[model samples]
Target: MQKKILLSYIVIILLAVGISATTFWNTGYNYIEDENNEHYIRQAELIANAFELTRFDSANDFSSFTKSYADKYNTRITVIDLDGEVLSDSEVEEQLENHGDREEVLDALRGEKASVTRYSETLGTDYFYYAIPVASESFTGVLRIATPFHEISNFNNSVKYSIIRAIIVCVIIAFLAAF
Candidate 1:
């Protein structure tokens, strides 16, 4: 009877620890991703506002302006006109294809805030992209900001590893207490 009671208590404790760890693992990843999304949205809006205030003489001028902001933020920035033409890219020097068909760009062109994570063929890397519509006196289009997806993945993986370690510690503690 005593052994049965002890075993039940150990099971309960282990179950509790497992549940808590699972919750933390999920919540941590969501919180990190949300924070990253918010950060990029705010940055994109700010850049769009700033862009509305300036008039670029040519694509080179536009690229120069975006390059400065990209360097400052350590992210890529691209401007796409209403017709889907790539007006300027902070990182790309050559003429690029139209972005009209991209889901995020389409959403932004329709005056909606948009975000997506995907592989970029041009940059040869995965990125988290955030875009917003911009309408200035001289320019009207979408301004997009992107950061490498690895950054967010690294943070999420760190959280997952920490949770796994915690679970292992808890299991060991539970076993010791059971004995």
Candidate 2:
């Protein structure tokens, strides 16, 4: 009976250790993903701010201006006035209501770096947005850039798959050692 109790306790301890280790590794993966997202947001905001600073104002239409800028920068760019009016977009000029209401746009209009993520109903996927303020002599506005979240999602999924593979390997090793 004492030997049976000892074996049971040993098994419980090993199981608890395995569970704790898996939990710890999963937490680390989440931290890495969060950091990657933050890095991307900062980079996008910086790109938007730089574009806003050097944007040409002499163009008759801001759409053309945005297109040219996007071509040059290899990223999407949108300029919005203080009131959330879309002044320029690299893609389309459709009447988008209250652009400033978005957290990133609002922060940019208020002279701060801001970022947000959301699911796009039209695109059927998630997206990330980064924005910063455009300061000029006369007017203050916002410059926003966006990228699809698929890139990050892919990376995260790869990481998760690797973690699972590692756990399976670990379990196999443990079983072999026990045997």
Number of the predicted model whose lDDT against the real structure is largest:
1
Tens digit per residue, CA lDDT, model 1, 1-179: 98998989988997899788878777877888899889888988888888888887777778887899999888899999999999889999899999999889999999999999999999899999998998877788999999989987888888788879878987888888788
Best by TM-score: 1
Task: Count clashing residue pairs per candidate.
Answer: 0, 0
Per-candidate RMSD vs. true structure?
2.2, 3.8
lDDT of candidate 2 over 95-172, digit per residue (tens): 555686787887777778887888755357777777878765534688777667887778878887887777677766
Misplaced by over 4 Å in model 1 are 1-9
TM-score per candidate: 0.86, 0.73
Segments of candidate 2 deviating more than 4 angstroms: 1-17, 58-75, 91-95, 136-139
Query: Which residue pairs of candidate 1 clash?
Result: none
Alpha-carbon local distance difference test for all models: 0.89, 0.71
